[model samples]
Target: MTKLSPETILQHACIGVMGLDNNGIIQYINPRAQELLVCDTHNGISLDTIAPQIWKQVKTLIQQGMNEQAIHIQGPRGGIEMVVSPVDKKAKTSSDNFNGVVCFLRSHEKFESSAWQYPTIKEMHLQFQSLLDHSYYGIYIIDGNGIVLRVNDVAAGLIGMTKEEMVGMPIGELAEKGIVDQALSPAILKSKKPLTRPLYVVKSNKYIMASGMPIFDKKGDIRFVVVIEHDMTIVKELRDQLKHARQVADTIKNELSDRNLLELKSHEVIADSPAMNQLLTVLLKLAKMDASNILITGESGTGKGFLSKFVHQNGSRKDKPFISINCAALPDMLLEAELFGYEKGAFTGASNTGKAGLFELANNGTIFLDEIGDMPFPIQAKLLKCLDDGEIRRLGGTKSIKVDCIVIAATNHNLEKQVQQKKFRQDLYFRLNIFPVHIPPLRERREDILKICDFYLKRYNKAYNQKKRFSEKCIEQLQGYHFPGNVRELKNIIKNAVVIKENNVLDTVLPPGKNKAVPISPPCEETAAPPASKGLNEEILAFEREKLTQALNHCTSTRILADYLGVSQSTVVRKLKRHGLSVE
Candidate 1:
């Protein structure tokens, strides 16, 4: 038999063969090598540019001083295997004389051998297994045919099975066997892309987030599916618990809000009328919001002060101090010192040890500035600064003390009109009016009048230990009257009636001739007084007749007469009969 030449043998060889110089430049590549590498160039080309994956493994081996030994590497293409061996042209005995390398490539389908026949392949497999075993999260790898090629210890444990029982099993079988909730690798193969889904392991009773990524071959075919599963049982439990807690908190808040609205009467706030009730509803929500600056506007004696306190009591700062000050009651200089506080020896009558102002004293609470419309212009500027910056300087000190209190200002005067008249600062008004609450006067919410009257009647009745009850006529008179002083006037009238009434059934509360409306004139010259000389009883009768005549002139009917005289209809008729008076 004749020995074939090296070039003829290489050309006829079934496996791929390539030669590289010391510089890693392809010196020669057989036809089979070109086909396997998908390279058109035959020579003088860098191996790094042609087969980068193979070059990487070659560089790794060379760096490890193992280039002389034949080593097998898993090539870039799926099922493509490579063997790299250092070439010594001068002598085959030592690698010191090696100047180039020869690479033998073969398809894995065509190669069959034992572990010892390819030590590098066995070592690479061991390295891969070691990496998978060391991972904290479950790692599962499947071949393109949906068969499990390898699984980490974590993955096997999560499935409640051993690595031996899982390898070579199809992914679909895991779901059908009740091992996992569903197959995730199939979706990755279908989309040829990564997919993430929530998964449940039946055996372990654990929730997991499985992220599947597809490994594709150079031909863009699915090569393998890699799935990483992270346990989500604790996170899911925490999220559910948080959601339940929030729902419970919301229910409690709603119940408390309704209860607070109903208990407004206990706070001495009468909101029975639709107008006042609506206002209270808004105030309740504002209180819950913990509004910083709120302005209460209404007529005098309409209970602005009570409403201010109501807001403070229901708010988040209920535990803090509540300091109230009447702006109109204090002089300018004294008011400033009282509000912002004064330093020691700051003024002529300053306190010896210095005093904290209402604002400072009311820190982290609420400060009710009653009659804020009457606050002096000079002090309004400083108050505005405090509101804007949340800090106030002492009356005569240089340092600013920070205050975190809610400022609720109440005013009977029309602040908008005052602002236009230049009597109040417009900016300050805007600041305080961020959340405005307008209490309707007694006349506007007349329905609340009877309720307020009854409340005060009961209060005063208890306080004075009296069982005096207003007669039907008296109730009619009280309800019909146009209260000029609002609730305050009503309260005082009820207190006086409950305290001074001699009989259990009180008939008259208002003075003899005082009417619901302010008199057009103080009682004409004739109705004013009887001549002192006329006897006492005769004088009393004459004066009563004169006031009756005057009331009759303005009142057209029995109801009108009763309302004008501040008496019930029956009282008016009886008084008319005694005085010989009648409506035409």
Candidate 2:
């Protein structure tokens, strides 16, 4: 049998083949090997001469006789696995006797067994190319030197470039265009793990989310990086819509809270008489004075506080805040802190950001101090200083802040009498008394009762959507009675009558009894003076005490007792206390 030559055997092989010595010198190469390497088939065409760098590394492994196994090499066309194995022992011995160490080379891209399906070298190459070209996601394979080894169609289209142009380019070029640098590169390199981040694609000027992972070989060495990009424009738009919705909701919430606060602070006051009109006029005038400190005096129910709001709104500072503080509402320490702000951490439970006091919030506005006579004596001096200097220092802060505001003080007590009795500071009263407006009791304004009652009736009728009116008889009865609780009592009476009187006319009478005409004593007796055995003063006093007892028994409240007796509530209280009776 004739033996074929090495050159003839290699030329007939179906895959690329080459023969190498133990030192990795290319002893022989076949036609297929030359075609795959893109090199010429010339004499002395050694592996080192064709691929100098890879040959040097393979030489060291070959010397150990371990048969450097199948290794994948990425090339321009596709990937190829090169398997190096020792020749048959007899062949190796014979070859050593003739030439040098011998090795048989086989291309791992092809195999015949079912276990190795997709066996043909051509089939494997086509399969890998199909995956790269048809993938849905953008895929990029970058080497350790930061040069792109291969980019799929998806990745090439992402940067508006062809696959051939993208290959061999530095990854930094994409970064320079502000495409995926800041978050992508550092995360993959530093953490050496998979990472996802938002990125802008320069070619399309679109937003995308990029995820990258480091690829490791069997030896755990980082070989390449694989990056995938997904577009994110729709997601960003949805987020913006959600943020706008939240802002609109917050604005509505704030508006509703402000309206509720306004309603809670407002109070109703009844007025009709000329005396009350005169007082209101004076208050309006005082409110116009930008620098005046007005004082209001009246009984508890005579609407002193309601007039204060009138003063604030009619003033030049109407557009600014109108802050009110009830002097009797809080304890001394709290009142101080509420009127004068405190520094952060000044006291336990204080806000971390510090709070603005009412006075600070009321700058360029008005501050209504209701029940001013009840303010503590110790704080009066500080208040007086604030009025005099037009400045206030916070409870814990060192700096003094100047303020421009109007101060309106209202109380039922006679401040002059309180000053003389040492219950109020004389200097503070003088400072606050730039203008004094005194409102009269409701009884003194008898003509205005029916008018005020009709006003309330109409208001309630409109509110309830009912058409109700007051009867002449009921109006007469109300006018005839003396209201000791003043206008406040009159409003309450009308409100109660309108609520119970569902019909067109309100004819409900007073609680004591229906109105009845008193019979005049038979024309004064000229002879009656003759029967005055007992003193007239004693008889009159006895008759007053008897009436008081009867009225108290018939009334449910001191206010009602005063109404029945045709006297003031204070007058009833004084008489009850004088008679050793507990009004409560």
Candidate 3:
């Protein structure tokens, strides 16, 4: 029972070991330590040079006479745990004595490769079987011949088969679920590369994405194929939802377009006064003519564009393309390209295949130029040329293409004044003024207010799928207001009311304007005073008279006044007669 010496112990131990003196120099090195450190002998190598990071801590322990301690060290090869213990207590005679520190080294847990080594083939098989039974992702391994060597529990469950039944089956059998074609296995075998594709498990009624990668052996030859399958049922469901939403949006768009067409067809120019009727007659006549270049002038939101469209749709070009372009919507270069086609490689980032301008697209049709006054002078010249001569030249191309399109210009500005100020071309203005169609403002067409409201109300009701109707009071309030935004403003008001109003009640929270509702006061108590004091009925009559007077003063004609009052033109005339007033 003799105690083994340090050398004898080191010879038998598997791990590396070395002893260091208090000066941080390697005093002893075992054969295993030399091999582990990748050094022959500690001839010129010091403990600090071999492991500087750990030596610092060791020096501190030695200086303080610390007891047994251990530290984890990282090296180029791998990680190691080093233990230091003092051999003798009085060996440090003057801090440079021959006293030694015994060092024991062991490989780190992660660096110890012995865990991967199986004692026997039976042990390795059991470990693989256990992993295959518990993995959530469908796992399968195939040999070089595309034959399945192993199948996991998840894979067996996905294909509605037991692991024992699926094992040793051809990999092609799983790929034939009608998700991917039958040629996928042969392709993977030929290419020896990874393949990924979306597939559905017919038996489980679930979608899955399958990926297979080739495993190469030490000779760089394909040894096996590892396939992983992920379920994609939620992803497919989300995609379907997005597609349904787009379809619903398209349906709504088509319905809106149909409603707009119906409204235009049923609309009538309602004006009882001679002056307004004369204007409407001229517009209607011009709308029917094919040669007139109509210029519609009005204030912003005053139905200039709407009337322009009405003219086009009712004209001889009704079957042709009715293209509308806002002249002021874009900058000069973009607007030029939009109107004129650009050649390939004309400028940086230009479309490689080039583009066709709007003018060419409007050939054999009619082009409605909205905000004509806002078009740049250079583009205006081109437009004038296109009108005089039926030809257009692309941005960078030399060829001039012939066009047969009618031009319909619309504006909210006075083009005559623009022409005088040299802002607009006089010749262009005269060409456009062949037939002038002036759309009177909302304040001038009071007779059409309620009609327009009813139209808009029905439109919004169908759009929102709600059963709502406007009350008589709501109609009266709408008619009484001066719509500065014109027909467009009226349409917006009706739309907003439709959204806010519930159960057929119009919300009174109107947009900002003089037409906003004023709070009315209750009738005052009649006191027994002099006979000269006006009665309640008389006072009410006076109030009504004053309102009628004010409305007539601000409006263009009686028809407008009647519309604002939400009453018939005859009622307005009768009221005017009773008050001894004339709508001048």
Q: Highest TM-score: give the candidate number.
A: 1
- Model 3 TM-score relative to the real fold: 0.42
Q: Give candidate 2 misplaced runs (Cα > 4 Å).
A: 1-272, 509-584
Q: How many residue pairs clash in each candidate?
A: 0, 0, 2
- Can you rank all candidates by TM-score, best first? 1, 2, 3
- How well does candidate 1 score on lDDT at residue 74? 57
What overall lDDT goes with each candidate model? 0.81, 0.69, 0.72
For model 1 the local lDDT of residue 510 reads 72
lDDT of 3 by residue, 69-183 (tens): 7776775567777778776856653345438687777677633466456466558868888887777788888888888888888877776788888778776766664533333
Order of models, best lDDT first: 1, 3, 2
Off by over 4 Å in 1: 1-140, 144-195, 199-208, 216-222, 230-238, 257-267, 270-292, 313-322, 330-366, 376-406, 443-454, 468-484, 502-584
Question: What is the Cα-based lDDT of residue 86 in candidate 1?
Answer: 73
CA RMSD for every model?
12.8, 18.4, 25.8
User: Which residue pairs of candidate 1 clash?
Assistant: none
Model 1 over residues 1-584: C-alpha lDDT tens digits? 99999999999899899888756789899987787777777699999998776777776655444544554555545456677777763454443456678888876656754443688988888888788888889999999989999898888887788999989988878788877888788878888989999989888888889999998889999899999988887888999899999999999987787677887765578768889888888888888888878999876668888888888888999999999987865569989999999999999989888889999999999999987987999999999999999999998799999999989998867799899999999999999999988887677777897888788888888899989888888877777776666776788788888888899898878766753543222311123433465588788888889998998899887668766755434346556877878886
Which lDDT tens digits does candidate 2 get at residues 287-388? 656755888877656667677887787678889999988775555777778887878877887777777777888899989887788788988888899899
